[model samples]
Target: MSRIPTAELSRYLLAGQLTRNGCLYSQIPRIPPARQLRRPSTGQTRTLNTQSDPTTTPTTPQNAPTPAITPLRKQLKDQAKAAKASGKKKKKKNVDNQTVPGWDLTVGIEIHAQLNTARKLFSPAASSVNDKPNSHVALFDVAMPGSQPLFQPETLIPAVRAALALGCNIQPVSRFDRKHYFHWDQPSGYQITQYYHPFARDGCISLQARDGIAAEDGEGVEIGIQQVQMEQDTAKTMAQPGGVHWLDFNRVGLPLVEIITRPQIHHPATAVALVRKVQMLLRSVDACVLGMEAGGLRADINVSVRRTGAEGLGTRTEIKNLSSFKAVEDAIIAERDRQIAVLEAGGVVAGETRGWSLGSTETRRLRGKEGEVDYRYMPDPDLAPVVIGEDLVARLASSLGMLPDAEVDQLIDEYGLSAKDAISLTTIDNGSRIEYFYRVLDALEQQLGIKADIESTDDAKQRRALIAANWCLHELGKLVETAPGVETAALSGDAETLVPSAALATILAHLHSRRITTKVAKELFWRAFRREISADTVTTAIDDDGLWFKELSQDEYAALADEVVQGEEKVLGEFARFKQGKAKAYPQGKLMFLVGKMMRQGGDQRMDPAEAERVLRARIEEVHLSGLGE
Candidate 1:
């Protein structure tokens, strides 16, 4: 077989035609490329044009369209050639984004947050990701003949909560539509979605802008969430050893809320932050635990650019199935540069769907994006309109306590955490841990019998909250981060299962009373966490582990003071001259440095720096060096 021309292979792959190992993987119903195989998000799609091979140089038979490489592989070649010719190259950024002299890039994201539920959206089948292949499939899930979708009432609850958390206006009436798509996993031939009317819309989320001309400083940027639709997720498709694709229907009909944001994001950091904010919000409400690796949450990003300060949105291309926050940022940056190069080279940024591979920096065109109409979206006759009552919406809204914004404010105002640290503590990824931390604070205050009125004083509360926040965010978080499967419910267990909240409080309280050093407090907290060691064992470790802070008795103090005065007699004369303001070599407060020689175990809670200063000053006074105050 002759080598396929790069451009010809690219065009064919862009058109969704591919062959591998003599098996032709045709575009199965040629569904809209931007939407999920099962559920759809806020996006535009294009009509597929079924024309003959457009490449004039192709010689391969129609039966075998051997694509030895991916579509983006060809695009990368084109990008490289353009860079070589124009003398402009892709910018490499490890810390910050490089400036593009004439272009401004904008991005938006669509998140499919898989609902954490036991059953599929429309069927009673188990929606377990770990279940055996096809073991959890229901008749409705597989589109068994004569099986119609019976809407699950429980599905709308989480969607409403997610929308409320996002500050969206819930629609009283939303309808489902049939979306035509082709994939073996989707045996139904069509997915039921809210194409014409979504469940919620018109919400906004605020994110910290990168401090520069790209974003205004001091003020955070707010991106609009266009709409969130409640839809079903598709099944998993795995490629076998010999070009065979296997479909697992176990994930079929899983609940998902497709969140679409407006294309106002300008910086890659902002884009990643926005994705993280959404993840935080979802976890706060238990609406979804969209871990990127769990396949629970995924996003498709749309990016486009234009001449700086010059116009309406440009032709956009999408990067799909971004699984992590870093992936979200990196893919956007790569796509932004690729589109800039294409436009600069006198080419067009095609309206197409692309896939991002973790192994490559470039994006591969998966299929040409289609408009909603191309999917032939029409009302699903089998399902009725989803009606939400005022009471139900109100209930969900009321239940969204301490959302990202409110939680951040409370942490800053009440807990006295810095704005940056507050943001980290309030996010959903660590949300459960933070909540558990708060409970420990309350339990600690109660155990010590600290009155609410007394402990609620701003200074008192903030001091305690800071201590708790520090331990939780630093020590506990480090442990949790390294702990496998920390994102799961097992990690969300009650504080008692780990270290009891009161036990944590005891550590902090001991720290405050100087009974233990901060270093020892952290160690005790860690040993007591997970309830592996008894509370009494934690207390005893302060002594047995030699963590007790040592204090100098009066005799010990006098001995050190006498030794310093006599041994450094020459230095003492220099100090006397320095104090007289006549002869000074280095001036940075002579007493603190003088006492430095006498101090040991800086972390020792029992050692008082002020006492050391007082002792040293008094001992020197016996030698009549009284001008040190100068």
Candidate 2:
């Protein structure tokens, strides 16, 4: 018996075999390397290719091919290396300086939005939108004894739907945790939320960069989403002149969806756009009303400034209770500048939470890092884990309407609307106005057998669609904006009630088909909307036989226009001279004055000014030709 050498044993192990080292063997067996190995053939011994020949292929008895690494495995290894390199590059690119550094901006947002539901999350009390302060309160709202928190299925659906629309993944199981903090408004001394296992995670929103700021091409920067959790809203606190804070418990125990974003936003404008996008998305899914002024939605912005290539994030400061997009932008800029100034003047930019003073356009310090209070987060003992099923997700997916960004894109592509017009049409002012406008459009389109053109078209269709969009954005917007003493709900409801679907469709259809001028459609719109007249009635009334034209005969109107030209003889002469290649300065001032007088004499009906101008030029030409003949 002979023992195998350690080197031979190592080689055997590399060839996928187990062999004992320094052990005597009664019978010696030989195995080849995998690359030169072959299946055994009956009554044949195969020889391995150990020669240094590059071209001569290895020949084995069974002709079995050697196993090689798969392409996918190779590709995976390459991708891992690339990712590692990218991460290293990012780490090495950090630039840090004591004086003002490089001013790298990072932002994160936390939104507290009230859910639009019929009942409170933990109580059976009504959650009506119009309920008076403290009127919809349950015993639990006041921390009543033995009051157990009960989950609201109805409220959770909207939040889940909203998160799904934002591209978030819903977790199978979510647990409610109690966040404890003492405040006069928080009677229970804690807020129940899903801190550990949130309902949804990793949602994203897209926003455009403002002028002078550079954004990435095609796809914008991806801001990592932390979580969107369901929580109970705190009661309202009203401060009186005598330093007394009165508590209203009506809103207590209401369901709220708190959406938190990662600190990836770099610019102030991007932060503002992200907030706006989130607000619109929440409203689109009917999760929360997008009310910034009345506090239906509130945002706390965390912003920090560092050197452009810094190693780590700078000291972050939270701007609390920003109710509007403008205020959020102002606060970020103000805070960034303040921090930069501090660093430039040899002062440390301390990590703190501050409140944005809208009146002063500044952020005042509230609490420093040393003074920061902990919420004492713990799992809620009373409530069990909320298990969401496929049925609920499917139902929500079906009902979750188009996101605001998608709607804007559709309007631009389908209706040939301008960016500004599309934005205006999709924006919800306190949520009610946008809903009402859409309801009106929807009903009108259905009633008039017209479909919404959400696709792009050629020149003719583009022009018509632009006209329709302009009318909707301008005339309709004015009606909604100026409706006196009207609550947003009333205004929205009234718009739906008063603006007949059939008439609106008729107007849009006529504009789409280019059958009516924009001016004529506007006049008809006022008549139909304010006077409750039908589209046909307004069209007929303004047509040849209608009262609008019947009030002034064509012959008399022509005579009055002729008289206007005669009164503006100097301007007419100049216009005629310019047309004849004399290139005289036309008397625009006098011609407009004469036209104004003629309009007054003709009962002040809205007329197309360009058409009137054409008529005046034609009449002036006729008079000049007659004079030449004479």
- Off-target runs (Cα >4 Å) in candidate 2 are 1-101, 209-219, 369-373, 429-464, 479-494, 506-521, 543-630
Give the TM-score of each candidate: 0.75, 0.67
Task: Give the per-residue lDDT digits (tens) of candidate 1, residues 132-228.
Answer: 5667988888666567888889878888999988889999999998898865556666888887799899999876542212342236888899999
Compose the digit string of candidate 2's lDDT tens values, residues 1-630. 665455554344333234554333324443333343333545433222232332344565676665554576677677668878777442221112112335677789998888878888888888764565566888777676566888878888778877886788899899999888766567778889888899899987656532112243224656667899999988777653322344567888888888899898877766767777777777777777646766888999988887777789988888888999778877877788788888879899888889886534358998864331477788999999999998889888988767777777876787677677677666644444445545545544554454566532466545555655565557776655666543454445334554554676666665454455565666677667676578566556656533232234556656778877655566666666666667656657656776677766665444444556555556666764355421
Query: After TM-score superposition, what is the CA distance of residue 556 in candidate 1 from its true location, in Å?
Result: 6.5
TM-score of 1: 0.75
C-alpha RMSD (angstroms) for model 1? 10.0
Where does model 1 exceed 4 Å of error?
1-91, 209-218, 428-430, 477-498, 526-533, 536-550, 553-597, 601-630
Q: How far is candidate 2 from the true structure (C-alpha RMSD, Å)?
A: 27.4
Clashes of 1: 7
Which structure among the candidates has the greatest TM-score?
Answer: 1
